[model samples]
Target: MLVTGVKIQGRADEAQWVTQFKVQYSNDGNSWTFVQHTNNQSDMIFDGNTDRSTISTNIFPAQVTAAYIRLVPTAWHIHISMRFEILGCKECKTPLGMKNRDIPATRIKVSSRGEYYIINSNDNTSTHHKGGSHARLDRFHYWVPDNDDINPWVQVYVGLGKIVSGIIIQGFKQHWTRHDFIKVQVNGSIFESINANLESTWTHDHPASHATLMFEKPVVTSVVRVEPNDCSETTRKLTNGNQIVILDCALRMELLGCGNIPEHGCVKPLGMETGDIQGTQIRVSYNHHQSNESRLNYRGYWGGSSPNINRWIMVYFGYVVNISGIVIQGYEVYWVELFVIEEMNNPTIGTQEYAANFDGYTPVTVLFEKLVHTTYIKVTPTACHNGYCGVRMEILGICDDNSNP
Candidate 1:
C-alpha cells in the first residue's frame, strides 16, 4: 500500500499541537513496526499548523505493506485526530530499497577475549589477532578463547538500535570442520540454537566458508551475539592441555531496512585548494584515508609549516548542496585546537561562520543548526596543538543526485 498523504484534524493551542508523527505498520494488527521516513534517520512528521493540516501526495516515500498503518504522535501539543489516505497499487518502490542498509558497529567484543588476542606472551611482538574488531568477515584472523567452552560467543554492538534481518558467521578452517551449529541472541534474549551449515567442500577459497542465519522477520535490536554450540568441536590443541572447542569466528550482519546514504566528499579536484603547505601532499578528503585505521596507509593532508593559527583549506563541491554537518579526523602528532567552518554561496562570497571545539587526534562530528546550501566550504584552524596541523575531513550533506539525499 502507498501512503499518498495524511489529513490531520485537531484543535489545540501552540503548546498542545502535534508537530511530529511517526507511521507504524502491523501485519497482525497487534504488533507494530516503525517505518523509516527520511534520510536524516528520523520518522515522518507534519510540521506547521497547530489545528488542522493536510499533507500532499508522496508524503511517505517508503512502501507500506502492512494491513494497518497508524500515525503515532511523538511530539504533540494536545489530543489529535489523523486520517491517512492509502493508495493501492501493484507495487510501491522506495528510495531505501535502492541502497544497502548494513549498519556499522561501534564496538565488537568477545565473551572470552576482549577485542584482540595476543599470539605471543613472552616477547609481545606477535601479531595481534583481532577477534571481532576487524570489519571484514572473510578474514582468517579471528578470536580464540582461552578455553574451548561450549558457550564461547562474540557480540556486536551497533551503538544505536536498528532493525536487523540476517547475521553471517565465518568459522576458522583448520582441517575439515567448520562452525556448523551455533546459538544466536538478540538484545539479551534467550539463546536459540541454529544449524547453519553449508554442505560443501572445505577448501581455501570455498564459497561455503561462511554461514548465514536469517530471521523469520526483521528484529529491532542494538546488540547481537553468536555462541558456539556443543556441535562445534575442534581437534586443535592449545598451548595448554585443554582441547579447543571454539575456533576463530568472524561476523557480518545486515539491517532489515534501508540505511541513510552517507554523504561523500568530491572526488574530482576541480576547485580544491589549500593554504601554504609543507610538501606536495595537500589534498585531504574522504579518498585520502580509509574508514578504519588498519587499512589506512597514507598520511593525511599536512600543512607546510609548524602548528600555527589561522591555517585554512577550502573545497568547492561544483554545485549547490545542503550540508548538515562535518567530520574531522586528526593525526597523532598535530590536531586542531579551534577551528571555524564557513559556508559560501559562491567561490568568493562567504556566508555564516561556525566554530568547532574538539579534542586532538580523535574524530569529531560538528553538526549545524540547520542544513546550509552552499557550493564552497572553508575550514580554517584558529589554533593548534602538538606539531604540524593536518586533518582528514568529510562533509555530511544531502546529495542532489542519488538516493542518499
Candidate 2:
C-alpha cells in the first residue's frame, strides 16, 4: 500500500491523551525508516489531540510504500494511550512496460549463453534471431531461436535503478510446452527459477496458457534475464511415417512493477533545460534581488532580495510525481554551498527536509535515499558562497506519475 496519512484518537480520559509522536514504516516489517524533520537528522514529531474525543490527523511528508507501519510516542498528556488508523489508497501492480512498447525494443537483448545450444547466436555460426523484443505476452508472438539453438535466452534492460516484483510468461498458442526449466536473473544473480507449465491447449485465435512468477522480495536492478536450465521438448508423428520434435522453451513474457518505469528507463532530467516546465511552475520565497522571474534554468539564478535564513526556491509540479534525485548547478561564482530539500504534501505538514552539500559551478547530482512522491519540492539554502546564494536546477526523475492505477 502507498501510505499517505495517519489518524490518531486519544484515550477516553483527557489526562491520558497522547501529545506528540513519531511514525515509522517498513516494507518487510524487519527493517524500518522513519519520516524525518526539516533538520534531516531526527524523526518528525507530530502533534496529537488536546481533548480526548478529538482526533489528530497528520499527513506524511511524501507518500511511503510499505506493508507495515508503527507509531512511537514521544510525549503525552499523562500517559501514552491512543487509537489510530493508517490512511492511503490501494496500489495496483501494472505491467512494467514490457508487453506494450513502453520499454523500447533496443533495450531487450537476446543470446545463446548456456551450453545447451550447438548454434551460438554471437559466434556468427548461424543467423541470429531477436527473442526478447518478440516476447510480448498474448500478441501471437513467441521467441523461438534458430534450429539447434538449444540455449535461447532473453535479457531486458529495465534501467539502472528500478524495482521489479514479478513477471508473467506465456507459451505459443499452437504448442504445448513446459517452461519449468526457465529462471529469472536480476543483475546477474539467480533469484529464482520459473516452475510454470507453459502448455497451451487453445487454438491460434484463443489465449494461450501462461504462468505468473512472483518474487519473495522486490528486486532493484538494471537488468532482468529469463533463461532455461535444461532442454525440454515434445515429439510428434507426421502423416508420412516420420517423427518431428519441438522445443518447449518458446515463450512470451511481461514484467510487473510500479513507479515511473514505463516513461523512462532510469533517472533523467525532468524538463528544466528542455522547457517542459513553465515559469508558472516555479516560485521563490524572498527574491528581493528581483532576479529573473524564471530562475529554474541556467538562463537565470534565483537569489533572495535580502540576506535571510528562510530563503527558499520551490517547484510546484501541479500533480503528484515520483522523483529520485535533483541536479544542482550554480551561476558563475555565486552558488549555494549547503542546502536541504523538502517534499511537501501540505502547506503546514511535511516540513521535513533532506540535506545536501556541493561546491562550485559544476553541476552536482544529489540522490535521495529512496524515491519520493509528492506534488511540491522546496529547496532552502543553508550556506552560500560570500553570503550570496543562487540556484539553477533540474529534477532527476521519471516523467509520469505512478501513484495512480
Q: Which candidate is the best by TM-score?
A: 2
Model 1 per-residue lDDT tens digits across residues 301-341: 44434334445665555566556555554566655655667
lDDT of each: 0.44, 0.62
Instruction: Give TM per candidate.
Output: 0.35, 0.42
Residue 289 of model 2, lDDT score = 48
Please estimate how well model 1 matches the true structure, expressed as its whole-model Cα lDDT: 0.44
- RMSD list, candidates in order: 12.9, 12.6
| After superposition, candidate 2 runs with Cα above 4 Å error | 2-68, 73-89, 112-130, 145-152, 158-163, 173-180, 187-207, 219-223, 233-246, 259-405
Per-residue lDDT of candidate 2, residues 1-405 (tens digit): 756557688787455778888899898999998877523667788777686776565656445678899999988877789988786545525687878878888777777421122333344332334356667887665675544665567777665345566777777645523445567776322224433333335332432665666655445444677875454556655575445445556667887755433233325667776667777777788763442333434666777335566888777788777676676667766677677777764454243343332333444445554456778887777767788876777777654424332
Query: How many angstroms is residue 302 displaced in model 1 relative to the true structure, after the best TM-score fit?
Result: 4.5
Candidate 2 accuracy as TM-score: 0.42
Best by lDDT: 2
